[model samples]
Target: METNSMEAIVLEAPGPPEALQLRELPIPVPAPGQVLIRVKAFGLNRSELHTRLGLAEGVTFPRVPGIEATGVVAAAPAGEFAPGQQVMAMMGGMGRTFDGGYAQYTCVPAGQVIPFRSDLDWAVLGAVPETLQTAYGSLTEALDVRPGQTLLIRGGTSSVGMTAAVLAKRLGITVLATTRNEAKAAALKGIGVDHVLIDDGAVAERVREIFPDGVDNALELVGVPTLPDTLRAVRKHGVVCFSGMLSNEWIVKDFYPIGYLPRGVRLAAYGGDANDLPQAVLQEFLDAVAAGEAVVPLDRTYRLDQIAQAHADMEANRAAGKLVVLP
Candidate 1:
């Protein structure tokens, strides 16, 4: 049912945002154990920014930039999915190892094509996969957040941070979300964050003032530069989760002695992937979105021609929320 070719954003070479070019690509067909998705929308991730700058080492040029997509299955294996079923694909080498959903159609591995029946729009679905999965997986697998627990979210203005706040709040956990700009305090509060703290390099001290006993858990979205403060804010036996590196610092130059870590304090990290994103978590998130219990903050939508603008917006930190590209 496809035409000879479809429009797509092709990354011909690694460079600035302008490297993305609109090209007419033949509609992709599914191979054995692969599913062809007629992509309606896809979300942009900071990792995509890294991939574009060739920061993702060993990635060759002429790649696609999207990591997740939502749409109907154009073709899938028998008994796997029928044509036109609502589905989403994420973090299974979609945009990394192969051509991804920067086009009108994309072929994804069948195992990674998750089918979800929902009334959610394409943009919402596109926004859900990476953000919610990462947040939920980190919260559950890494932090194990629970009711009555006081948690701190470092880099709380980012999409994953906001998602963690919502999921944590919904689970009866008290969330202290952070922002470098105090101006976003009100905005953070609007999105179910119980409290908003300004991250002014004194995050540990600020948390201590709020909860002198220290918080039960902390999810560090910012990297190593801020992880020390995040760990310091946690009580003995409390957990600190490192999930993202928005601060661009990947390594801890000063590896302190084992005793330097708080006694009995546990450090955990979650890297989201196809396996990390359990169906139960996706269902819980989707049901929340459907019931209006969770707010999926969609920033804006852009056409394929606006791919550069999308990347620029994300790189400049101008994206206030999740940004989706509609094809």
Candidate 2:
């Protein structure tokens, strides 16, 4: 391969995991206000999965797909970071609008590439971007989890769910994490969560048995199908942050009808937007992980060539935590 070119996973036409073709493409040259990233590692997010399956609209063909990444600055117009300085970025129309992080090199808007300072490895840091951002937003922005409060993680095994559980526990919050997989319950408890509940359809019933008043906050990672149970698990006036749609159902019909909502319960939602995450906040979160104050568990690592297998494991429910791809 030419020195100016780099390896990348390109989506010629959205289809199955096999459509993510590994090819040698010319490395991107940063335009003014943008920096060329020597992507060391990138994460596989559900948004990319949806795009690769042709589920996302407005996606032109022959595009590289990846929403979040962690790496060093290869080239940049004189700015806040020197070449080789580490950085990370998520959303910001990364994979959806143009070429993103599924490559050895990516050109990102300078404003979007957050200077992430941490001594963690690329694979470890790569696990932090999207998962940490979403988890932090849901905990601090939406749920406002406080010390001594009780929290519920509906999709306990999902990346967001697990991250939220760990952050809440660190804040002295009692977390009641739920998972449909009974075998995973012990793993949840080992993560410092106060309790782990089997996520059967009777989640509300089980929760009520443990805490009669219900949990103080709930992070509903699942979608419409589990929202009702999640609502019932929260105490009156408590908050429920409706985040990911693990069930693949985006909207709930008649969700606004008062009867379906828990009395005095508040609803909040989390969506990925580059601007929504301030640089200082992102830095602080990464600092905590670097200091061992919070945990962002990484499940699997794949080479750029094994991109298809990574997506396959994610879709098969085999990954117990975040999946990172080393480019």
Candidate 3:
């Protein structure tokens, strides 16, 4: 078969959203242990925006910037994937280290791709994996959240936050989510979240009202500024799983309740390491989605060319659920 060029959104330079340019680039060939996918749909993550703005370290310029995608295999090496098989892939630094899904075709490791159930929609499958996996990893693997426990998700309306809320609710745990937007509180409650608190100066007080003594676990997606509050919201011996920093990365300077440290409270960091743990998390999320226990609510969909608008929306904190890009 003759090779041909394909359209891709490339970050020619690391600067702003305008640096991302759509260009006709040569289609990549799958090497050993890798498969080339004809991407049907892809999803945006905050890390991709960080990479584009040169905030993420070690990212190469002229790179593609999508981490999660659902597509059909177009080519694979011997003993690997078969052509025309629908699959889902997320994490593994897809858009960071290698060419990623924001293109007509993406070459990724076969091990990173898993076959999706035949009944699943490509757009939903595309939006599900990444944030779901991260949420699963943080909750089950890191925090070990259990039934009867109260869990607080800092960014409750965020993609990962909502996924965590759903997973925790399925596990019979009470979920308390914090969002800056009061408008999403109703939606969060409708989705089975036990409580939704608008992120504000009174957040700690409101959380204390819901949990009384304190929550059993906290999923801190927003870093630094919220870390002190997260520590305060957890019961003694409770666990806090620090994940993403949607706000800022600076350390909190406020004095915290260090006297409570004798109670055996633990702070653990999760995600960003996309190796063995991520693979396990991915499998668990896929199983949950396949079982109908999990759902990825897509807030919006954009064509590949509208990536700039997607980033703008995300940066503006205007989206409530996962943002998808259709190829």
Candidate 3 at residue 144, lDDT? Answer: 86
Question: For model 3, where is the 10-residue window of minimal lDDT?
Answer: 272-281
Regions of candidate 3 where Cα sits further than 4 Å from its true position: 1-3, 250-263, 272-293
Q: Write the per-residue lDDT of candidate 3 for residues 122-212, one digit (tens) a residue.
A: 6777777677778878987899888988999998888889888988898999899988989888768877898888898446678888777
Where does candidate 1 have its weakest 10-residue lDDT segment?
Answer: 56-65
lDDT (tens digit, per residue) of candidate 1 on 1-327: 737788988887778999988888878767779988999889888778878887775566687667888899888765588998988888778777888878888888887877788888888888888898889899999988889999999989888988888888888999998898877777788888887888888889989998997999999988988888888999999999999888766777767848557777889889878667877778778888899888887878998899999989888877556889989
TM-score for predicted model 3 compared with the true structure: 0.91
TM-scores for all candidates: the values are: 0.95, 0.95, 0.91
Q: What is the C-alpha RMSD of each candidate to the true structure, in Å?
A: 1.7, 1.7, 2.7
How far is 242's C-alpha from truth in model 3 (Å)?
A: 0.6
Candidate 2 lDDT, tens digit per residue, 36-115?
88998898888888898788867888899998778999888857578999988677778878899999989888777788
Compared with the true structure, model 2 gives a TM-score of 0.95
